[model samples]
Target chain A: MTWDWAISVLGILAGLCTTGSFVPQVVKAWRDGETRAISTRMYVIISVAFVSWLGYGLVIRSWPIVIFNVLNLGLSGVILFLKLRSAPPRRKEA
Target chain B: MTWDWAISVLGILAGLCTTGSFVPQVVKAWRDGETRAISTRMYVIISVAFVSWLGYGLVIRSWPIVIFNVLNLGLSGVILFLKLRSAPPRRKEA
Candidate 1:
C-alpha cells in the first residue's frame, strides 16, 4: 500500500511538471510576440499527442492523466496559435 | 481482447507522438542556432518531468513509458542545451 501511494505521487508529480512546463513557453510567446525559434511542427504534433493521451487517460480512468493532458492541450494550443500567427508568409501558389 | 489491443495501440501512438514532437524543436534550434523564442524554464522543467516519468515507468514495468521518456529526455536535453548556450549574458556585478 505504501509503495502504491509512492508510485501514485510520483505519477502526479510527473504529470504536473510536464503539464506546467508549457506555461513558460506560452508566456514567453505571448509576451515577446516572437516564436521564430519555436517549431510549428513540434507543437502541432504535440497537440495531437495530448489529445491521444487524454483519450487513453479517459479509457484507463486516470484522472491525473486526463487533467494534465487537458491543461497541456490548452497551453500547447496557445503556443501553436502564436507560432502560426507570427510565421512568415509562404510563397504564393499559382 | 480487441479493446485491450486498441487501447494499447492508442497508448503507443500517444507515446510516439509526444516523443517525436521534440525532434522538430531540436532541429529548429540546431539549424537556426537561435533559441531566443524558446523558454529555458519550460525545457528545464520538462526535462525533470521526463526523468520523473522514466522513474515511474520503471516502477510500473511499463516499457512504452520508459522508452518514450528516454527519447524525450534526449530530445529535450538538446533543446535545453541550445537554449542555455545561446542565452544572453547576465548582468555582471561590480
Candidate 2:
C-alpha cells in the first residue's frame, strides 16, 4: 500500500480509538451516578478545546477530526452536566 | 488571520486538551495505588493506537500530532506498567 493510504487508515483508527477513550468514563458516570471525581475546570477547558478542534476540522474539511471532536464534546458536556447536577461526594462530619 | 493559521492554532489547543484528558487517570493511579478499575485490554488497545497515531503524524509531518501522541503514549505506558506492577485492589471475602 502507498504510504499515504497506510497512514490514512491508521489515522482513522487513531481517531476512533481516541474518541473511544472517553466511553468508559461516560459509562462509569452514568452507571455510578457520580462525577465528583472529575474536575470541573478540566471539563470546561476540554469542552472549549473540542469546540475549537471541531472548528479546525471544518476549516480543513477533515471528517475524522470533526466527528471525533463532536463526540468528545458531547461526552465531556454530559459529564460536566452530571457533575453539576450530582451532589458532591459525601463528606464525613468531623 | 488566515483560516490555516486559525485552525492550526485551534488544532494545537485541541491536541493539548485531548492529551491532557488522560492526566487525571494517571495521577489517580499513582496516588491511590489502584488501577484495578482500568481494564488491561483497554490500555493495550490505547497504547497500540497511540503508537499508530505517532506513526501517522510522522508520515504526515504534523508536529502537533506527533508531540501529543508521544506524550500520550508515554502516559498510557506508565499507567499500564504501574497497573501490572501494583497489586490488584483487595477484594472483600464473602
Please report the candidate that would top DockQ against the real structure.
Answer: 1
Which structure among the candidates has the greatest lDDT? 1
> Model 1 over residues A65-93: C-alpha lDDT tens digits?
89999999999999999999999999899
TM values, all candidates? 0.96, 0.74
| lDDT tens per residue, model 2, B10-49 | 7888878767867776776777776544545556777888
lDDT of 2 at B47: 87
Q: After superposition, how far is residue A77 of candidate 2 from its true place, in Å?
A: 2.6
Model 2: residue A76 alpha-carbon error in angstroms: 2.7
Which pairs of residues clash in candidate 1, taking residues 3 or more apart in a chain or in different chains?
A: none
Name the lDDT value of residue A84 in candidate 1. 94
Task: Evaluate model 1 with DockQ and give the value.
Answer: 0.92
List, residue by residue over B1-94, the lDDT tens digit for candidate 1: 6899999999999999999999999998999999999999999999999999999999999988898999999999999999999988999999
Q: Which clashing pairs does model 2 show?
A: none
